[model samples]
Target: MHIGLISILSLVAVVSAWLPSDTDLFGPEPQTNATFSNLSAGKGRVVKKWLPSSGKIRGVNLGSLFVVEPWMASTEWATMGCGSSKSEFDCVMKLGQDAANAAFKAHWARWITETDFDDMASYGLNTVRIPLGYWIDESLVYDSEHFPQGGLAYLDKVVGWAAARNIYVILDLHAAPGAQVAQQPFTGQYAPTTGFYQDYQYDRAYKFLQFITNRIHSNTAYRTVGMLEVLNEPVNGQSSLVNTYYPTAFSKIRETESGLGITDNAKKLHVQFMNKLWGSGDPKSGLKDLSNTAFDNHRYLKWDTSVKVSQAGYIAASCADQVASDGDKPLIVGEWSISPADAVEQSSAFEVKSGSNSGFYTKWWAAQVIAYEKQQGWVFWSWKAQLNGDYRWSYKDAVEKGIIPKDPGQAYNQGVC
Candidate 1:
């Protein structure tokens, strides 16, 4: 999700046509049959198990991909100078279809490349959480869909790249069929309402989910796609609906993917569910009763008005909250960032220097985050930022500048998964 004008992989070489450069990690060409031997155990539940307290995953999110956040590409949006656009759909439509298509093409090509993925692996991150809007698949987009058409192909390329490097992918449905959370452009709904809670939208979203499950589970190159979140951060009070959706989605996915030769019941792809913005561990939380499910909570410090502590105090508070909320449950901190309270309203130029709150604060914060997340696992809000100066939000810049430790041991505690 893009906030105002603010926010937002890979190694090449195993991919034959990915890049003009000759630095492929997998080999001269990508492996035809990829295997997760070291990471997979007893039907691949080992990988899913790696998500909880038993094993740990340190990772980063691939944000602003299928969904674009205006602030990430503020400069591009500034060219149009459209006033107060709501979502990417509005922004693109404002630009006119032809111009929007061309601009998106350039932005997509440059925003992320094979070299980026290579950098992530080198940074020691074991998992990459990729955010995707529901319309990525053409059938889901319907008549109003006007963006360039290779969305799924681009996703396949990224997943394939991750597989070659032995990194896992958490394919997150950031935007559901009808804007699960319509406030942001990330949800792909240009209108005022998310529309996802309605019966019509819910049915469309359910079918879309089924389509996604069948496609990925059937693809060999996507063996590294370890988890598929039903939706990212649905609005509050939809818990009962979300709860119903989860079991139905799980059953649909399970039935569709059952042909993959799975014998052990525990070893299957993880279907992650959020609490749907319900209070932490609420009795009505959708995730409470789902099987083969994982809990995902997005934790943020800067957004909490009550976060008046110093870096140390903030760490203690955050760690305590996470510990309490996720005691022995299979969970992941699906979204987090290194942003500090003191620098909350600053510009990217002013914010990037000294690593958000100076070197000592940033390093200490990163260490604490890694340590806290060891109970289960965590994914930073983003791997990179559109504004290079905004290193506080970008794992790539943080690691490169040494504000955050680049040691693989810190980023990857769960071995290969």
Candidate 2:
């Protein structure tokens, strides 16, 4: 999800020494009698419902943790001397594998912890959308391919914590093998040459999917992980997604689960695809048959430069976003923000400053929440990031600033909408 800019979190106490390795993932599982109240999205549906009975998925993204964005580090990336670098690829290349791994490993360790999960639970938030790079599974990367390894241990620990807090997680493949998009660091690399469409890349991606899917279904620590977003923002090479990738991934994931002796549709993982092919054509254009799936659409009004609408018009826009939910599968707004359009930011009448006392942001937030709930749910772009006071992409800052209410369930702007 592109923002006015780019991610981090805070308030996590040191977790006890428990890291899940390949050996640890399946062994005497950590004694967590976690009641997965949130991860259980629903049961007895061919096309599942990812929303709760009472409300939508009031959630935030751990966007920058696994997929690093240099510009928006919660702590300044420049101070780390990697500021000039555009993405993790540049950082790993510049710092070399070992040095870059140390920096990133440390960042991943401290940026988020159980305390952050507790904080999210306190707000009654139901889900977390975790964006991760394809490189997390080391086997896929070759000698020449430079990507940090040993990330699965951290992922295992984080999802276990989420389970304890009764929060669900959507493990998203943010960056596929050849950098699905040119979005730096976020895509795990600064891939100027988009090669995800190549046959070799698809094979690697399928392997990655099998690896991750098996992990989530088989690992008790990952009980909180409910959805596997097959890909994130596939703006390039769109035809393959519907005609080939989506169908194949659906079969591969289902087959993997079935092989694990999981046959009931209820116990299976829900795969999420882009609500529509982004920079390509319609999602339904050549969509094949798939089951146990949902859709994800990201709406960032911040980039609209055409015409600035009034605050009331913003509510109208949120209320009017029915097209995002037009698909047969359930929809979730994977990313959105309270940030106004570029034109609105420049408007003298709106006074659109980040975390401004202008009730504009609050109303906009509520409007989208109410509207998004009408379909399935929504997850705000990010939980924490570098922008000091701007709540545009930072859900943490928004909640702290009172622009977004601590209890998201309260429809503060429901009357207006």
Candidate 3:
């Protein structure tokens, strides 16, 4: 598809006023009336009762924040001259311990602000999936000096912010001690030998989860954090290891919470595990013995090279087939976007410059609403993107341009759908 660079850059002018600078986005006063103290003991879930007609996990991923990917945020890692770096860990190492810490200290504050959380609630998103790596934990056997301190504190700040806005948080461990997937910077892997299949890596990952669970249990505000995902996109062949780790971590987390005297049944957190390659297999088959668990699947229509159909046709076909296979599983579309992949040709349906264009927007919108109704809920791939023409993938721009409904509840019937 042809990208209209002029049209995309002009949007920067429209959003510049709302974007966070050295000045706070919330201004002198906060926008949310909700407080953590009054936050219901009932944490969000994907099961039957938890499912709202609006959609369960109706949210978007806070990508390129905790997990630094070069393409998404090149300036953040630019200090290391990491333009061509393979992973976040490698980028940090290249920057050296001291420089890396200094860069992150500045970035952690600016990358995302409290106002962003307020905006999420204002626009219809009810949840956020924050992806973080194992290195953030002080107890993990990693290069502590390289990673800046107060990582958990930052996380707590986000939880509190979400709680104040009455939004749910899903603490996703995007990158484990060793990488879980290859050819992806989010995995935080530099060496080929480091991966989930290794016993030592698995052990450290489990410990990190245990530590995180304890931290959440201790925080009153963080009770808004309703779900804890074990891992993200393990290599396809490692399904057996992932299957084994799911129950082990699930039981361990429950055992840890019980030991801490946190017995609120409503706040019972669901442990989420992704099926091989984003719901390629039956989640029930893999998680038969586990309870209080849910399945996560990423539905990126553009990425499926096997399907060479029009955008609307592909979306309809995929949604119909996947919805049928979902059956009774508590499934969540953890990541999805309307952006076409790479340099390949995009469907003529989405050639328009503005996300508000009906031909491009309606098809994607209908598919998502249909998917949410069929399964538990869905979280879009990203909350924002750079001044690229792919406005559909950028939630902020989409909402601003009236492409996506400000109230996600209204998204079901915004127009042509």
Candidate 4:
């Protein structure tokens, strides 16, 4: 579920000594008029809200250096030919570290902070999914037993920054040790794998989650770091990979970290599992084990050219049905993009594109999303990136065309929502 939705459902209102309004990192001036509404009255209560319907579920994936090393370019690393060779892989790793440090020194350390949080808050987005790479804690480096000090320090800053603004953060481990996205870091793609379902890979991933859960759950400051994405885009073409690996890994996470102050519901983890298992139909029986966990899924409806518009209803129904089977665990569409061809097809059965129809698909899909605010919430993929041409798809264009408000500071002020 969108972190905002979770926050709302678990809403708690607090009247603490008001701190100075957080600064804006990159956008216009802050909105002094913005006020916090206490959903509950209590001392030191944490305020949470169901995702807001102020506007479209406009959110972005803060990627690259924040999640992966900017210097670790897929093309550049591939050219280095570091496959399976210890010496070459070491060199690549060093380069990646150097790149991460340099990027942090250059802008990442400054641009991503309370100000950026303020920018996002003003932008009408109620949630931000921060993608994380396993290496940040030094766990992925060959032979390293301890997490990295510098990495944890940087993330701590991120948590404090987001919390001050009342913006919910989803700590997404985008690149696990096996490099959940093989072409990306952490997967040791420089070192190839047998495929996504490797046993050792699942073990390594579980350890990573355990480490992260332990660290985050222990810290009250990071209580706002809602939902841990087991993996990003796992069921793409590798449905078998997730089908084989997710259940086992998910079960281990619950057994290891159940009842931590992290969630209110006990069956949260089970709900997450059944939601992931819903579509295949192999598990015909509904999820017998339910919990407080929400089902996380990503949809790039436009990416699969073969999927027809007529299929949109079925897709939505199937997803909703899966979540409902698990006592209606919150369903969050962690990622999605808009495209015209798909829009045309789904319009008959679902909401059609509107306005100029130029970017009407995005608007239509967003409307459909907003319509479901009470049922579930979503976080769109991506915020800003220097590698616009390669990594960013529609996001880059959307930002430029005013689809995504560029002047982040003025977003909430526009009153469009």
Choose 3 or 4, whichever is better by lDDT.
3
TM-score of each: 0.77, 0.83, 0.80, 0.61
Q: Cα RMSD for candidate 1?
A: 8.8
lDDT of each residue in 1-417, candidate 2, tens digit only = 111100111112111111111112122232344221212322321222222233357789997888888766846566545667888777778888888777877877888888899888777687889998888878788677776656777888888798777577888989998887765568888878676876788888888888888777655666657688888887754677677777777778878877776765656777888876244444555546555677788877666443247677677787666636356356788888876765556566455463343576777788888878776677888888877566677888777777777788676534647
Q: Number of clashes in model 4?
A: 20
Q: Which TM-score value belongs to model 3?
A: 0.80
**Top candidate (lDDT):** 2
Off by over 4 Å in 2: 1-55, 277-288, 305-307, 343-357, 412-414
Q: How many clashing residue pairs, candidate 2?
A: 0
Q: How many residue pairs clash in each candidate?
A: 12, 0, 0, 20
The residue ranges of model 4 lying beyond 4 angstroms of the native Cα positions read 1-43, 46-58, 69-91, 94-100, 103-107, 144-149, 184-196, 235-248, 255-288, 307-328, 339-375, 387-400, 405-417
Worst 10 residues of 3 by lDDT: 13-22
lDDT of each: 0.60, 0.69, 0.63, 0.46
Better of 3 and 4 by TM-score: 3
Q: How far is candidate 2 from the true structure (C-alpha RMSD, Å)?
A: 9.0
Question: What is the full ranking by lDDT, best candidate first?
Answer: 2, 3, 1, 4
| Regions of candidate 1 where Cα sits further than 4 Å from its true position | 1-55, 76-85, 96-99, 144-148, 259-263, 276-289, 323-328, 342-356, 408-417
Error of 2 at 257 (Å): 1.0
